[model samples]
Target: MFQKILIANRGEIALRVLRACKELGIQTVVVHSTADADAMHVRLADESVCIGPPPSRDSYLNIHQIVAACEITGADAVHPGYGFLSENAKFADILAAHNITFIGPSGDHIRIMGDKIEAKRTAKRLGIPVVPGSDGAVTEEKEAKRIASEIGYPVIIKASAGGGGRGMKVAHTEADLEVALQTARSEAGAAFGDDAVYIEKYLQKPRHIEVQVFGDGFGRGVHFGERDCSLQRRHQKVWEEANSPALNAEERSRIGSICATAIADLGYSGAGTIEFLYENGEFYFIEMNTRLQVEHPVTEAITGIDLVHEQIRVASGGGLSVKQEDIKFNGHAIECRINAEDPRTFTPSPGTITHFHTPGGLGIRVDSGVYSGYRIPPYYDSLIGKLIVHGRNRVECMMRLRRALDEFVVDGIKTTLPLFRDLVGNADIANGDYDIHWLEKYLAKEE
Candidate 1:
């Protein structure tokens, strides 16, 4: 086991890793930007290092500074919680070169899965079902048109190296394909420094489902089931739940096995997620997230597994302690991303939080990085906390979430509490009839 680990991230996820380290008797060193010097994670860590200024290029995303911090702190391993450099293959290689373990998949695995086009090909080769689309990058407009025609109308043009919906466009017709292709290529180049784009059949009103897989570097891998992340906006997940109501027992088993086999074939290590788009009773692979997801707490609540601890144990050359049959989902769990933004306009509201109150009692868990009087800087993501709740069943989980959201209060900055309050109360969500476009349409109607 590692005596100490450095967390190369920020916000609630950073605190999440810290708490996990404390439970395992591992010392934690948190790296923060100058703007987050007094953040909750910094104060809670055994040691804290200031990397750089507020801008992510000079701070959180600065690989050199984070590696230096790990060296200076003598951390045996580094845990990247979700964003920033979590999926950067070069960063993982740098840590390995320094003899510091990276608590995630191998650099080669990341490099292969980080590129959407390459990942899709790998998945197909592994016999995993993938969305019908271009087999490789579409460099020319004619190729894009050809691929789009074969895949049918309503195809999505996505950047080969993109995530977070940054370099994506949907085309419904041949005339629209040209503009969509050009725009997608330009956006991909600007966002990821890659002008390559690929086409995929777009599933309208699809449900966003992802399977969480963990592997111990020694040829064994297992999945903890799937999370329904259909509740999203602008392709960013807002609410997530485990034991998706849409998936039946057979579907769960099939997808779980597919995800496990795919990662195992890739020689993947550590924690990763295989995301899929489900529509009309069919599931198609979308992409793979090569790190711990932001909404991983929901899976933890249901499985009672400490994923962070598992990541550390795997990095330390330990095999999976639990088997597939041993893995069990005790209940339904839901996680709401509580961001420092307005529910109506969806604009970030960054400032000092005058009053902060979190919900408690049975089934309520809050992962937060800001306390009362903490100033939220404008230079980063607006997420302030995560509110996770568990219950014996989905119905009970929804009710508990409604109550928890009502109980949460943070003054002096706008939050998405009201949005969740309205969402949970909606009949469609209560009936589990909502899809990816449900929230967007609901919000549009509200206008």
Candidate 2:
């Protein structure tokens, strides 16, 4: 087992990894920017290193500096908790070269799935259902239209390396395809430095479902279950739930088995998620997150599996602890991302948290990295914490989430608390009538 691990990210996830390491008897070294020197993860870790200034490019995203921190701490492995360099293939290679274990999948797996287009092809090869779209990247305008024509109208153009809802555009007709192609290409180049773009049949009102998976590098793993992350805004997930209200026993089991098969075929390791877009009882592959997902809490809530602990065990060369039949699903779970932003406009709000209080009761869990006097840095993502609740079923989960939201409080800084307060009382949301576009449209109508 790894004696010490360097957590290579910031905010709540960094703290999340630290706590998991503590339980496993592994010491942790947290890397942070100047703005996060006083962050919760740094405060609790056995060792902390100041990598650079507040800017991510110079700090969290600086590969060499983080690698240097790991070396200085004599860390045997590195745990990238979700963002920053979690899915970065180059980062994984660098760690491997330094004889340090990267607590995720192999670099080859990351490289193959990092490119969204290649992942689609891989999924198809593994007998996973993928959306009908271009066979490869559509480079020219002529080729773009040809694929779009074949796929049907309202096709979506996406960057082969895109994520977080960027580098994607929808074209309802041929005329719109021309403009969308150029814009998507430009956005793709700017965001991922890859102008490569692909096409997919855009589904109207599809539910975003993803399965939580773990592998031991020997083609052995199990799918804990699936999470419903359809509650999104601007391509970002805001609310998530496990044991989606959409799928029943048979449907759930089928999807879970298929996902586990795909992961094993790829020989991937550690924790990952296979995301899909479900419409009319059919699931079309969207993408696979080669690292832990932001909404992983909901899955953990229902399955009682410590995904991070599982990740560590695999990275330590230990085989999977649970087999296919060993896994079992439990009650429903829900998670709400509490970002330090404007509740209505969703503008970034970063400043000193004058007062803070987390809700506590049966089935309530708050994963946070800030304290009452903590100053939220403006240089990174606005997400400050998460509010998760589980119950006997979805109905009770929603009821508990509403009650928890009422008790939760954060002062001296704007948060998405008010927005969640509104959502908790929303009847459509309560009944699980919302889709991927529901939140955006709901916000638009309110505006």
Candidate 3:
């Protein structure tokens, strides 16, 4: 086991990793930016290091500074708690070169899965079903049109190197394809520095389902069911739940098994998520995140498994603690991302949180890094915390979430609390009759 682990990130996730390390009796050295000197993770860690200034490029994303922290702290391993360098292959390689373990998948897997084009091709080669469209990037308009024609109308253009909905455009008809292609390419170029886009058949009202897979790095793995992250706005997931309301027992079993088998076959290690788009009883591979996801808390709530601990143990050359058959999915779990944004306009709201009172009681879990007086730096993501709840079933879970959301408070800055408050009473939400665009459409109607 790793006696000392350096956490190479900040905010709630960094705190999340810190708690996990404490549970395993491991010492943690949290690396933070100047903006996060008073952050909870930094304050609670066994030791702390200020990597650099507030800007991500010089701090959270600084490879050399992070490596230097590891060297100075004598950390045996580094755990990137999602975002930042979690999926960065070069960072993983650098850690390996320093003889320090990266508590995630091998760099090779990260590189392969990080590229959208290569990942799609790899998924198809692995016998996993993929969306019908061009086999590779369509650099030419003619090629894109041809693929659109063959795949029928209502095609979507996606960046070959994009994620988080950037560089993505949907065309409802042939006439819209040209504009969508151009828009997708331009956005892709600006966001990912790669204008290369691919065409695929777009499913109307698709549900975003992702399987959580964990590998012990020795050809053994397990799948801890799935999460319904379909509740998104502008391609960013806002609310997530484990044991999707859309899937039946058989569907869940089939997809989860396939995801687990693929992880074992590919020799993947640590924690990873295989995301899919489901429509009309069919699942098409979207992509694979080669590190822990932000919504991992929902899976942990339902499965009673500590994913961070698993990742750390596997990276330390330990086998998995549980098998597929030994695992049991207990209840439905839901996670709501509470960001410092306007509930109505969704504009960024960053400042000092003068007052903050998290909800308590049964089935309520709040993972946050800020306190009542903490200043939310404007230089980073607007997310301030996550509220996760678990119940014996979805009904209980929804009700518990409603109560918890009502009790929670974060004053002195606008938050999306009003939005979630609105959702709690919506009938569609109660029935779980929503797709990826459901929240967007709801917001449009409200506007």
Candidate 4:
């Protein structure tokens, strides 16, 4: 086991990794920007270092400063918690060159899976089910039109290396495809520095599901079932639940086995997620997140597994402690991403939190990085905390989540709490009859 590990990010996830390290008897070193010098993670870590200013490019995303901090703190490993350089392949290679372990997939694996187009090809070659689309990058508009025609209408043009709902455009017809192709290519180039875009069949109202997989470097891998992330807004997940109500036992088993085999075939190591889009009782591969996901707590709630600890064990040359049969899903779990935003206008509200109150008791867990006086900076993501709840079933889970959301209070700034309150109380959500577009339509009705 590593004696010390450096956390290369901040916010709620940073604190999460710190707690995991403490339980494993590993000292933690947290690196923060100038604005986060007094953040919760910094206060809880055994050591803290200031990397740079508030700008992410000079701070959280600065690879050199983070590596220097790891060296100064004598951390044997670096754990990137979800964002920033967590999925950057170059950063992983740099750490490897410095003889420091990266608590995620290898540099090669990250590079391979980071590119959406390449990942699709890899999955197809491995016999994993993938959505019908362009075979490779569509460099010319003429080629894009050809591919779009072959795939039929209602296709999506996506950047080869895009995420977070950016660099994507949906075309419903031939005319829309031609115009969307040009605009998508330009946007992809500007956003991801890659002008390459690919076409894929767009499944309307699909249920967003993902399977979490963990692999030891020695070629052993296992899955932790699936998370129903169907509740989304603008292609971004809002609420995630484990033991998806939409998947049957046979379907779950098939997807889980396919995901594990795909990861093992790729020689993937550490923690990763294979995302899928399910519609009309058919599943299609979307993309794989090469690092821990924001909604991972929901999976942990049902599996009784510490994913962070598992990542550490894998990086330390330890095999998986649990097999496929050992994994058992018990109860339903839900996670709501609490962000600093107005529920009505959906605009960011960054300010000081005058009074903060978190819900507690059985079946409720809150992962947060701010205290009563912490001011939310507008320079980064709006997410402030995660509210996770578990119950014996989906009905009970929904009720518990609603109760928890009502109790969660953060004054001096508007939060998404009201949004969640309205979400959990909806009849569709309560009945587990919702698709990706359900939230948008629901919000539209409120307007």
User: How accurate locally, in lDDT, is each candidate?
Assistant: 0.91, 0.92, 0.92, 0.91
Q: How close is candidate 2 to the true structure, as a TM-score?
A: 0.99
lDDT of 2 by residue, 1-447 (tens): 999999999999999999999999999999999988889899999999999999999999999999999989899999999989999999999999999999999899998888888899999999889999998899888988888888789999999989877789999999998899999999999998998999999998899999888877887767999999999999899999998989989989999999999888778899989889999999999888889988888888998888899999999999788998988888899999999999889989989999999999999999999999999988899999999999989999999999999999899999999999999899999898889999999999999
In model 1, pairs of residues that clash are: none
lDDT per residue as tens, model 4, 1-447: 999999999999999999999999999999999889889999999999999999999999999999999989899999999989999999999999999999999999898889998999999987779999998898887888888888888999999998877889999998898789888888989999997889999998889999999888677778999999998888889999998999999999999999898788777889999999999888999999999999999999999999998998888888777888999998999999999999888799999999999999889999999989999988999999999999998888888888898899999999999888887878888888999888888888999
Query: How many residue pairs clash in all the candidates, one count each?
Result: 0, 0, 0, 0
Candidate 2 deviant stretches above 4 angstroms: none
Clashes of 4: 0
lDDT of 3 by residue, 142-231 (tens): 778888999898899999989888999999887888899999999999998999998889998899999999988778879999999999
Indicate the residue-level lDDT of 163 in model 4: 86
N/CA/C clash count, model 1:
0
Q: RMSD per prediction, one decimal?
A: 1.0, 0.9, 0.9, 0.9
Question: Clashes in model 4: which pairs?
Answer: none
lDDT of 1 by residue, 116-206 (tens): 8889988899877899998899989898888888889999999999978888999999999999999999999999899899999988888
- Residues forming the 10-long window of minimal summed lDDT in candidate 3: 136-145
Q: Give, for candidate 1, the lowest lDDT window spanning 10 residues.
A: 259-268
